[model samples]
Target: MSQFWSELVHNLDPYVPGEQPKVNNLIKLNTNENPYPPADSVLEAIRNATDDKLKLYPDPNADLLKQRIADYFSVQRNQVFVGNGSDEVLAHAFQALLKKDKPLLFPDITYSFYPVYCGLYGIDFQTIPLDEDFAINVNDYGDQGGAIIFPNPNAPTGRLLTLKEIEKLLINNQDKVVVVDEAYIDFGGQSAISLVNQYHNLLVIQTLSKSRSLAGLRVGYAIGHADLIDGLERVKNSFNSYPMDRLAIYGAVASFDNEEAFQQSCRAIINTRETLTDKLQSLGFKVIPSTANFVFASHPDFSAEQIAQKLREKAIIVRYFNKPRINEFLRITIGNNDENAALCTALSEIITS
Candidate 1:
């Protein structure tokens, strides 16, 4: 809206993140953040990193963290690329790999950020619609000489595509780069990182924010062919050499160190997600089969907006996208035992009344 703004800035429509409530008492499930805290090791490492080292710059390459991620995923250190978050990693990908001669392809109802990134980079793109069940049918994506990207257990919808389906997509589009954003992969779905070694054009992006419970720490990475990683590195270095800070590097490294705590938390969230789905269905909400840390459901008798408003009144918040095809659905994050119970109690009251 400013006269000084460039044409690109003037035409840009920014992504709106989930609301972070001002008060702490509210049960916040709007953003699909993990309900568990970061592993004790992660916190201890971050605290230990706070020293005179704060005066110096962090490793611009983030070699240690990259090696940790690479080892954990069974990929080489050269194939791993770390960034501020998966969002930043994705931004680099869109710029380096996705912007091609043909329009990039993605799901119409997938992550809203994809389109925003395209707009920022001036990348031409096309959106393929999900099927009637809100699931991605890879057959819809024909080999068109353009790049492809989508979430595994797709955002807001929480519908997961199996590994076989993903491999099929990779085979069909062998010539084009395929990016699978696995931000929620650990909750239930298998990571495509397992196949990155097989597919030269495959790039798998993940975040510690969800399953690793490091949303505040802001660490995300991508695993792919060393050549692709080098391309992303070129874009990253050209933009910002120091994307990962000292504390974030140490903390992210520690996150990979404690596999037990990480798996335990993911299991807890999966259990809660199932329980919540059953409860919602019993209350007349048609719940989607979700493999992520959240559930997407719609009530037959109540409106999504009305449910969201009522829940807010009860100090509970869930994500409601007022967009096409999914306006009636609410994306509810799986909370811990007490929080889940409280959410159910609030919903029961609201629906019964």
Candidate 2:
């Protein structure tokens, strides 16, 4: 904390993303990334894009990918905004819309990044408690000020709030922005993108990381009214004209193109998640009902840290949060069939022994 740094940097508490361990064959299940590989068409598109075209700059606006997302979501191109990843899209969003006269509102337990974003942007914010069962209560937001943002099927917990409940909040707070971070929407939750046309203040953020199996490519987008999209575009242009490189643009467009493959992958994850939930419950775990590609659960007989540590010793890894409200839970990403089998076997030994 010496030297002359920007006051913003000095005052920031950055978001720490889940670990991407370098160890191979560890049965990684911490990050909610898709366990399957991306569609072959996405690979081919990236390969085809890596050409003499490298000498030329990508469309500063990433027009092709924008058009693809626009068409897929039945929105005009002007109503869509793309970025290197949803995190960046969210950064642009915080700068563009969330800053307000009153403190922003979010769930006390949410995508840990929300508070970090607020700190980074110097935006005042407040947290509302999740219900006793950890579900979002839209009625509690009636006295709120400023904007609101939260993951649809909230991270770590994997519990989803219905679109109807989201609409209630939007209707109640019609004057302020409501940013629904739908990063996991494709897994099972209904998208608020469908309601964007009805609510001008709604901005639905999504990423290709989970459903498209393109976390490596880092492409994310937002769907909203033209005015809301334009605000993000202005902030993005001011920050980085080329948030997406050539390969990312091509690959993201291809991911949207292969809609069938994307749907198949998401369905597979959902199926595996259901089976895993049963296995965890049989092992005496209380698993949260998850609509995302992960499950949050814990055994009544064991500590969350112990479960995570035991799994690590077995060369399996999942996430364990030591924070409040849900400190006893473990967030396990739904892996492939074989990986899930390995996890189940590992948990059987770990829990019993």
Candidate 3:
């Protein structure tokens, strides 16, 4: 809208993030954030890091945090790349690996940011539609795109694809880069990070924001072949050398130190997600089988927009996308016990009324 804007800027369509309300009292389930708090050790580490060292710059390479992540994933330190968040890590991937002579390929119903990143980077792309059940069928990927990227338990839909299916995709498209965006893999689905070493072209991206309960800390990373990591590093260094700050680095390192707390939180969310799905099904909502922290469901008797609005009135918020093929569906994040109970109560009231 500005005269000073470049042609690329003028044509860009930005991604819309989930709303963060001004008030704190509302039950916020719109964004798929972890309901549990970060591990105690993570908080303690972050607090301990706030010292006179704040005056100096954080390590530009973030070697210690990279080493911790590498060790956790059973990969070499050279194969791990850390960034401000998975979003940033993904941005680097789109720029470094995905843009090519052929068009990029992704699921039609995927993280909306994929298309946005394509637009930002001027990368040509095509979308492979999910099946009637909102599940990805890897057979449809073919060998056409320059690269491939899709979420394991895909965003908003929460439908998961198995590692076998993923391996098949990798085999079919051996020549192209395949980026598995595992932003929600910890909820129930297995991570593709396990296969990164087997497939040199495979790049797995993950965020601490969801399962690790570090959305505020803003840490994410990628695991891949050392060459791919080096390519991402080239893009990252050209853009911003110091993506991870001191606190984020130390806190993320501590997150790995406490596996028990991390597993406990993931299990709790998975349990809540199943309970919420069953409750929605009983209330006449056609709930998709979700392996992520959120459930995607639609009530045949009511509009998704109406349900979202009514829940908003009750101080509860869930995501409702008015896009094609999924306009009637609502993506509801799994909250804590009390929050889930309140959400069920509100939905029950809405259904009965």
Clashes of each: 0, 1, 0
Clashes of 3: 0
Which is the better candidate, 1 or 2, if ranked by lDDT?
Answer: 1
For model 3, what is the alpha-carbon lDDT of residue 293?
94
lDDT of 1 at 88: 97
Query: What overall lDDT goes with each candidate model?
Result: 0.93, 0.91, 0.95
Show the lowest summed lDDT stretch of 10 residues, model 2. 138-147
Assess every candidate by TM-score.
0.99, 0.98, 0.99
**Cα RMSDs, all models:** 0.8, 0.9, 0.7
TM-score of candidate 2 versus the correct structure, residues matched by position: 0.98
Local error of candidate 3 at residue 9 (angstroms): 0.7
C-alpha positional error of residue 271 in candidate 1 after TM-score superposition, expressed in Å: 0.7
Tens digit per residue, CA lDDT, model 2, 1-353: 85788777788888888999998979889998899999999999999999998898789999898899999999999999999899999998998999998999999988999999889888999999998777889888755678888899988788899999999999999999999999888888899999999999999999999988999999999999999999998998899888789999999989888978998999999999999999999999999899999999978999999989999998889998889878899999999999999999999998898
Clashing pairs in 2: 84-218
Look at candidate 3 and give me any clashing residue pairs.
none
Q: What is the model-wide C-alpha lDDT for candidate 1?
A: 0.93
State which candidate has the highest lDDT.
3
- Deviation of model 3 at 35, angstroms: 0.9
Off by over 4 Å in 3: none
Write down the worst ten-residue block by lDDT for model 3: 137-146
